[model samples]
Every structure is written in C-alpha cells, then in structure tokens.
Target: MNCEEATKLLDGYLDGELDPITSQQIEQHLRDCRT
Candidate 1:
C-alpha cells in the first residue's frame, strides 16, 4: 500500500466504503508511511 494506491483509496476510506482488509491496509500504510 504505497502512497499512490492509498491516495486513490482516500475518498473511499473517508466515506467508509472500503472493505475491512483494504481499510486495514490503508491504516497500516498510514502508520508506516513517513510522508
């Protein structure tokens, strides 16, 4: 889950439209990401 991928999913994440697995991935990415 890189920044670009995460960026594309941002809207879905905010809207709570993503699945559990995907949301977890995004959350983990955010935690590990340094930007």
Candidate 2:
C-alpha cells in the first residue's frame, strides 16, 4: 500500500482495531519510515 493508505490505517492500529494482516503492513511501513 501507499503512504497515505498506511497513514490512514495507522490510526486503527494505534487504537487496536486493525486485523493482523493490516497491522503487519502498518508495522512494516513504520519501520521503513523511521529515519
């Protein structure tokens, strides 16, 4: 997914609402984005 999509999903992740697959994707995105 793209950055915008990931960012949108991140909120759900923070709130513990995302499913495992989406959460994993978001975690990977966070790791890649950490500078």
Q: How close is every model to the real structure, measured as TM-score? A: 0.94, 0.76
Instruction: Please provide, for model 2 over 1-35, each residue's C-alpha lDDT reduced to its tens digit, 9 standing for 90 to 100.
Output: 66899978877999999999999988888778754
Give lDDT tens digits, candidate 1, residues 1-35.
99999999999999999999999999999999999
- The model with the greatest lDDT is 1
Clashes (candidate 1):
0
Indicate the residue-level lDDT of 9 in model 1.
Answer: 99
lDDT of 1 at 13: 98
Tell me, by TM-score, which candidate is best: 1
Residue 24's lDDT within candidate 1 is 98
Angstrom error at residue 28, model 1: 0.3
**Model 2 weakest lDDT span, ten residues long:** 26-35
CA shift at 33, candidate 2, in angstroms?
A: 2.7
